[model samples]
Target chain A: DVKVTQSSRYLVKRTGEKVFLECVQDMDHENMFWYRQDPGLGLRLIYFSYDVKMKEKGDIPEGYSVSREKKERFSLILESASTNQTSMYLCASSFSGANQPQHFGDGTRLSIL
Target chain B: DQQVKQNSPSLSVQEGRISILNCDYTNSMFDYFLWYKKYPAEGPTFLISISSIKDKNEDGRFTVFLNKSAKHLSLHIVPSQPGDSAVYFCAAIRQGAQKLVFGQGTRLTINP
Candidate 1:
């Protein structure tokens, strides 16, 4: 079984504040991803890391960035939190293969006021 | 442009009945499809998948049927249980592509 752990399950931040969402995987997968799940919009990818120090922007990358200093850890940074940024954030990891399934963490529900 | 689409936003079914969810994709380059189930406050979990070469794949009570000509796919859950109630998402990936395009998702509710 693969274990993907997020630093926080619930978060609250004020407008203009910076936010950090951390994720760690135990399986040492080479691929890590950050996504935001919204109603009627599905899971939109924010950022993804294929290897340590390598990152790529996904569909919705504005106002967000990512860090992959190590193979087991990936972090998402919100430069300036806003009310619209409040949503459920998910972290997933997978092996570097064509059809490999991604394992996900429980997710963090973020609230920006 | 939305590459993948789940037309049905929600579906309700009895515990012992069959529940069928449908998905469609516009991109013909997609060679692999996957289904995921997500519970409230939890991330989406991989349910089942099918390759373009195969039309059907079955696991336990869940089965996925794909129609390459129609560019559509469907998931059927037999003898649906309360535990099957969740948001189901359909995703697609091109051959050798690392990213997956997902549908909006369909919420399934099972009535006891």
Candidate 2:
């Protein structure tokens, strides 16, 4: 089975602080994505990396950034944490194809104070 | 512009009864669609999928139907069990695209 691991299951941070969420995939997939789940908003993509050092902005990319320095690791960075940024963040990985389904991690519930 | 939409916010059904979840898309470029089931505090897992070329696909107790002309799809679960209760999200990917656009999702509850 494909396993996507998120570094944090839950996190709390104060406003204006920088927060990082890490994700690693064991399946060696070529695509990685970050998304935030909000009530009545579903899962909105923040950023996605199709290859190492390559990134693309998704629908909601403001207030966030991503890094994919290596093939297996992807990181999401919050420029400055805010209360509105508090959400369940999900990391997913998949192969380079239109038919492949992306495998997701358990998600990190971040609370900004 | 919410390209993908799940009109129903929630659905309730009795145990051993059939559960039908609906989804609609406004994008004509989308050629593939998928359904995912998510539990609280966990991630959404892939459930079933259907291609725009095919109208229906079935697996065990789950079935997916696609209506290309209407840009609509539905997931049918036969004899739903209590464990089947979860949030169902419908997602779509445009032709040759790797990114998927998701709907707001519908919460499913199975009552005994």
> What DockQ values do the models have?
0.85, 0.88
- Native-contact fraction for each model? 0.74, 0.80
Docking class of 2: high
All predictions: root-mean-square deviation over Cα? 0.6, 0.5
Instruction: Summarize candidate 2's per-residue lDDT along A44-97 as a digit string, tens digits.
Output: 999999999999999999999999999999999999999999999999999997
Task: List where candidate 1 sits over 4 angstroms from the true fold.
Answer: none
CAPRI tier of model 1: high
Tell me the TM-score of each prediction against the true structure.
Answer: 0.99, 0.99
Q: Candidate 2, residue A72: CA error in Å?
A: 0.6
Residue B108 error, candidate 2, Å? 0.1
- Give the interface RMSD of each candidate: 0.7, 0.7
The count of backbone overlaps in candidate 2 is 0
